[model samples]
Target: MCRIAGIFDPVAENLQQRIEGMRDAMHRGGPDSAGVFVHPQLPLALGHRRLSLIDLSEAGHQPMIDAELTIIFNGEIYNYLELRSTLKHYGHEFRTESDTEVILKAYRQWGVDAFEYFNGMFALALWDERNQQLILARDHAGIKPLYYSTDGKRLYFASEIRAFAHAGKVFEENSKWRSAFLTFGHLPEPITTLKDVVPLQKGTALIIDLPSLHIKEHRFFEWTFNGKLKQEDEAIALMRETLEQAVERHLVSDAPIGLFLSGGIDSSLLTLIASHTRKDNLHTLSIVFTEEAFSEEKYQKLIIEKTGAKHQSFLVTKAIFNQQLDDAMQAMDQPTLDGINTYFISMYAKAYGLKAVLSGLGADELFGGYPSFQQQKKMKLVEKMPESLLRGLQRMPDHRLRKLSYVGLQNSAAEYLSYRGIFTPVSVAALLETTEKEVEDDLQELSAYYPVQGLKNGNRISWLETNFYMQNQLLKDSDFMSMWHGLEIRVPFLDKEVMLMAAAMDPAIKFKKVPPKYPLVKAFENELPEAIWKRKKQGFTFPFEGWLKENEYIRPSNNAEQKLYQQFQQKKLSWGRYWCALLMNRFTPLP
Candidate 1:
């Protein structure tokens, strides 16, 4: 809901100025208000840009401080009223009816374990003045971002990486992460595109002692799918109840709330539940296409009628795509293969005067709605092939066989990544100056040290989809792109409670073969019409490939990149490969 930045150091003369510079870089994300905090005796400083979502009064102002602790926070804490009541029981008095004050008090009451009680999206930095330590924590799902860098003297952290970059912090593109970007279309969690800068992982926290600079990392929560199996009807009941609760919690805001209706099952279900929960008329937004094949106005209309929601649809023409491309590019905080759709949607929401919106981003990952779910069976078969044969098949001319070779050679995480990635190691190397062996070695090291380690079959695939794809691409894209318009995008499906419920369900129930999101659809069958559930899944994309044929900026100075573009135009390249090449060429500066 806001942008937060800070400097933690033993000695920095102009700490306030540097912190202000970081906050100012992301001024668009929180144009409503700004504040900075610094003490004369302390070298630390914290800066905040407020969007004013929960409490409109200045009482909600951040870098909120007491005698012992000071806090800078971003995103919503939906259950703040409840937490506030609990803290009152503990004899903590609050001056403001704002979540910011609740967090400060909660930290006082529960210490580091306070994170376990928060039931919403957030990335926060707390300076425990008494302990002389700084605590940084991300929400359970990483719906918000927190990036940090340390020079062994000072620690710089912010809501966006560009903040640090703009505040005179130099960020050299790390070669390893650059190569990983070519393969995955995103840098994985804790790995920023820049050297020495790290994104705090979801469900994780870091404590830094101010004087010693000693750091300790803790995993407060980890998503796992291991709850008791239930009868189909019972499971459906649980899913329905959990989803409705999540939607209600996500609706907590002082600002006007809107829903991004993609005309898909996830959005439709949310519309149904939210309409039932909110007393006022719900505003719904959708993107329509002039291209009939790509449009879904009919389904969107169905949801509107069913929910009695006021609907606003935007028609995207080739002209609009051309017009918005530059603005979207400038809005981008990090180079991504996705988020162009989110950028345009956010602009539409902003135009309608909406400050906050709900998206159905994590439903696909949580409920097995992607083609990757179905491909797991084939992967298991490929996994049976001997390593000797896989190595030999790696030399095969047929690309399909070569991809199968990857499945045979690597673990489930690496194999799933190879299946969903932008490029194979060999293909990525051909595009970059790095060799194929170097790319393979980096991938091997990553797989060996994988954080979501030791999960198998469907569970393994789910972890990768949620942790890597959703964390890196979907949620990260949502943050920068929507915040570009000074908008807050909330995901009910990624809510801590909702994620735990979905993760705990038996994988077999979540991944039935007939319709995608089988359990979720059944849970709300009365709420969502069958037509929405039965429709073929289409990706939320602009006419990017069509636009690529005409885009002048897509042309690259690098010969390898140009060749990849040529292959894409000739229809000889994979979609992921073509997009990676286009993005690299568009973003990489010519010397």
Candidate 2:
């Protein structure tokens, strides 16, 4: 994990200072090294901050150049060794064993087609001096972030939004900012707090022509649930094999690695697999709460005892939450209601001197770990009613009936918002002092951005969870929060090979062979400890229910937040709703 930034203005001023300032703004992501590349004749510059995961030598330094090609990269090319071999066979020699160099040669050898061959997480910018072109690309899963803003003929791209401040960029609030955040509890991709900046979509690249400054987008990989149907057992067997291969690929780090052992079925399965494969003892980490109800220490211990992995536990208390809140807030590149737990875990990992850790983040999204899968099936009874009758139930007292009100149309946004939305359009408008129609319009616009037209039933739900929830929120938050602590949170579940295989399976067998995660459990049920899977699944939890209400700094700052906080204290709203309400107060742009 690293940070990248660059400027593409022909009449650029103070290029050196601006690029370096932008890079340094994100220094926490990559404190190991920093560099800037500027073309002598062209109005282009690239900046990079290196975390040094792959190669621990000067050869790993980025702003890496070969012949007429210059590049700045952030994230690991996990399959660089395999790609390097292929490149060498094709008569492409390399001076360094670094992934950055491998990428440079790969891009040189295959042109834009090389991106399709890459198997790991990455956000990169390549400058072709001869062709007078620049290519900006993000990984298939959006595990790493790359944001860009365009003003007339100029372009500014960076790994973090805070970097834009260093370049003296003006920040305008996106029209959808308040509405989307309130509805989703997180900002969806291609949309940020800033009006001008948007994420380069996952699995897509922007090819910019330097001469005219025109841009053309190229999509190298897009996941579709269109694989040939397989038997339940066959799919499970292939899934296990694919996951093992993915984990082995993820473990191919020059630096030491560990797992964020959540003690859930997904993480426990990975732990068991890693234990069987590796000779050395595994390293695992988790947060333990004094409040036993919220702590998974028992299950975590079971995994530790089974694998004999070296484990570290951070005992969290209210005092620690109060002490860490402000700094963690700074780590939030974009205001998010989730990912606070990830930030704290990353901080503990960094203090323990670990550079990288594995997480089972995408396992739930890929393997139907959410109630939405079952809920979708039940909603068909409600779906039988007329559209007008459904809309009449929008104001119902029961949450399920209210969610059913959103199902009149074939809409991904409606389905996702029904399950995970933070606020209704009316509430968002009231909070932001805007019209409800405007908020409704903004929500409608999201459907076009994440259209899962071909998918159906559980497959459709999986697509929405993976692309909308995981892509826009979980992955983005995990990247900023962990990388800000200089810890690379590697997700084996989200790997290209693993995700595609999971996406291909039929929903009948893919979802709920057990309560939470079936494929992962079926893959390793024998070796994995029973306590890990037998226990009731507690989705991402923190002691925030008590901690946030007690903390002075996290309290209400505005009228809307005050009302939300009062409801929070009354036990009417979950900690997550109150948390997002808190951030809206902090991050909302002024008129």
Q: Pick the candidate with the highest lDDT.
A: 2
* Candidate 1 TM-score versus the reference: 0.95
Per-residue lDDT of candidate 1, residues 28-120 (tens digit): 899889999886676778899999888889888887888888898998999899999999998999888889899999889888899989998
Q: Poorest 10 consecutive residues of model 2 by lDDT?
A: 394-403
Segments in model 1 whose C-alpha atoms lie over 4 Å from true places: 388-402, 588-591
lDDT of candidates 1 onward, in order: 0.82, 0.83
Compared with the true structure, the alpha-carbon lDDT of candidate 2 equals 0.83
User: How does residue 568 of candidate 1 score in lDDT?
Assistant: 65
The clash numbers for all candidates, in the given order, read 0, 0
Give candidate 2 misplaced runs (Cα > 4 Å).
Answer: 392-401, 588-591
Alpha-carbon TM-score of each model against the true structure = 0.95, 0.96
